[model samples]
Target: SLKGEARAGVQFVKAQMGAVSPATLLGLGVGAEGDMAERHAHHHHHHEDEDHDHDHDHDDFETFQVDLPALQDADLFLERVKQVIIDHDILRLKGFAQVGSKPMRLVIQAVGPRVDSYFDRPLADLEKGKTKLVVIGQAGLDERAIKAALQS
Candidate 1:
């Protein structure tokens, strides 16, 4: 069922991409017994015995948004964020921040500890000088500690 769902999602994306198959677009093609297929099968089988309750389906991961004060120092702010990512095993992080006195908004993107940032555009009237980020990681993240570290 997982594989079927994955195929359906891929097909939908393929249709959105002007009928181009995802594998062709990405230059990837795998046979039925391919390594990727094997891995997917193994993963599916490994979780076959787990409960499939819809209410608790998202127990594997957690997502939360953090809004904090404007960051004064870019370097310090990035360091703190990196520490949080490492400590929490964050899978992905993305958001915008207002660096002190900077006329533009800082766009932050991170994937598994590799953080990147740049000034995207001039801050809007209402969004100026604000730090807002969405953090995603496996379940059991220390929300209080993460908030405290980023706020400081």
Candidate 2:
């Protein structure tokens, strides 16, 4: 039967990937969306006493957002962003910015020290001229310093 074959395939995969959590596999969306979240939460609570040792500590990750008025100079804005990335040791940064007199929104993305940006679609009728960004890094990020540096 097809159902039996599918079950066999899943069992084989699980056997090959020993110690893989059901939550991790369900995160791939193999199950219904609503049930996936419930299963994930249950698995999280259940695994607190397990012996798994993660390579990196989840408590060491931190994230923050930066929101400001539309920027006038793209060059100056990018320079400041680069400096912030270097100083803060950012792992990933991404967001959209409204640059001066431009019809389209500027999309910014950075991974490590590499930064990239491009103009996306034109601003909608209700969209305001604003810059919004989300920054992710290891714990101990100076949120105040980062916001001040970017705003200036």
What Cα-based lDDT does every candidate model obtain? Answer: 0.78, 0.78
What's model 1's overall lDDT?
0.78
Off by over 4 Å in 2: 1-56
The digit string of per-residue lDDT tens for model 2 on 1-152 reads: 54474412133344454787776766675557657544433235444656754334566789999998888998889888988888877788999888997879889998866789998899765445889999998898999999998888
lDDT of 1 by residue, 37-106 (tens): 4343223444555654333435678999999878899888898888888877788899998999888999
- Model 1 CA deviation exceeding 4 Å by range: 1-27, 30-57
- Report lDDT (Cα) of residue 64, candidate 1: 92
| Global Cα RMSD, each model | 11.0, 12.2
What is the TM-score (0 to 1) of candidate 1? 0.65
